[model samples]
Target: MSNMLLTVEQAAEELKVHPKTVLRYIREGRLQATRIGKAYRIDRAKLDAFAGVASGRTRPPHGVRATVIVEIPALTTEAAERMATFLGAAALGGDAETRPLHFNTAFDPTSGDLKIVLVAAPSDAARLLELIELQLGLSR
Candidate 1:
């Protein structure tokens, strides 16, 4: 069966639980998902497996994906743009076998809040974090 992507609300409805519960499942590593901006998309096969349905597809090993969220309050717009640009460039130069990298940056100039979400292979995640640390003078 072709896998369909479901939103958190949809998955929660299917499981008869609140949307937050699905988010918890994702956070606890009980379910697999692809982070899109501030939202998550769950594969139908994974949802079926989580619900104890036979999907005829084996689940991939845990920790196959690495998700990193970084928040910077009071960050200047210039700084946010610089960080995003640097991270985007770094994210684009990975091996083809590496999982596609997702780098999302949300900035609110009014509040000077910057939130960055990155999802990719573990190595790629680490590298991106290093870039971020270096960019923000957090290297140690």
Candidate 2:
């Protein structure tokens, strides 16, 4: 057990149970959680302690991280600017599982060609895309 933060879903995956089950544990005061706004963050140490008490052995917390890169082309200047701004903000405001996001932009005003490069951890990639889509009003 170490000082690691995991979401309820991740904890549930580690415990081989549903996320709702994790929530139930939290509600029942069986699992320790830190409520962050609407979500719950579980500590790795506490999770391992709980597991040891439950199963008579401690299980190591899973810590796997992946880097992901995504590129978008044919974006308008306004859209590219918005995406860049959002990426910058998101990088600064990563949650428990999210890593820093890196963004690169190449825009040619004369040719109206805009290319955006997004680098982020896998856990945060989906969220980054959702934000991009929301900001740009794009379906992709």
Candidate 3:
């Protein structure tokens, strides 16, 4: 079989689903694709993998237990700015744009630390914690 890459629309057509459904699959981690800049190019094999044509199941590699949301309060303007940059970088690095994820920041004068909330897959919670530690200079 030719290992041709397909767009979301094409994949949706083949799967008899809507483009949004394909997007949802990508967001939910039920499908995998190659990121070409801002676009996702999925190969035929990957599409088959997602459809369970080969695997017989469309579940994530592991079960997701819960979603984690973290809050950090910013005490200083400098810290807040730094945290914002770090969060953006981390999101990009984590490919969160194509995954089930939400990242946001807020300020609280009453608290002394930067506040960030990350709602993500349970498997990624540990990575989020590691990012928090790195942000707090607690981990290298």
**TM-scores for all candidates?**
0.53, 0.42, 0.46
Task: List runs of model 1 lying over 4 Å from the truth.
Answer: 1-63
The prediction achieving the highest lDDT against the true structure is 1
Q: What would the per-residue lDDT of candidate 1 be over residues 1-140, giving only the tens digit for each residue?
A: 53789999999999999999999877755567899999999988667655655455444567487889989888888988887777666764543234467768899999999999988778888888888888888888
Question: Judged by lDDT relative to the true structure, which candidate is superior, 1 or 2?
Answer: 1
Error of 1 at 14 (Å): 31
Better of 1 and 2 by TM-score: 1
Instruction: Return the clash pairs for model 1, or none.
Output: none
Candidate 3 lDDT over 1-140, as tens digits, reads: 53789999999999999999998877655577788888888888767645535333355676455555666654587787777666655554443123444567776655766567776666566787897787788896
Quote the RMSD, in angstroms, for model 2.
Answer: 13.6
Candidate 3 TM-score, C-alpha based = 0.46
Query: Once superposed on the true structure, which residue ranges of model 3 sit more than 4 Å away at CA?
Result: 1-65, 95-98
lDDT of 1: 0.78
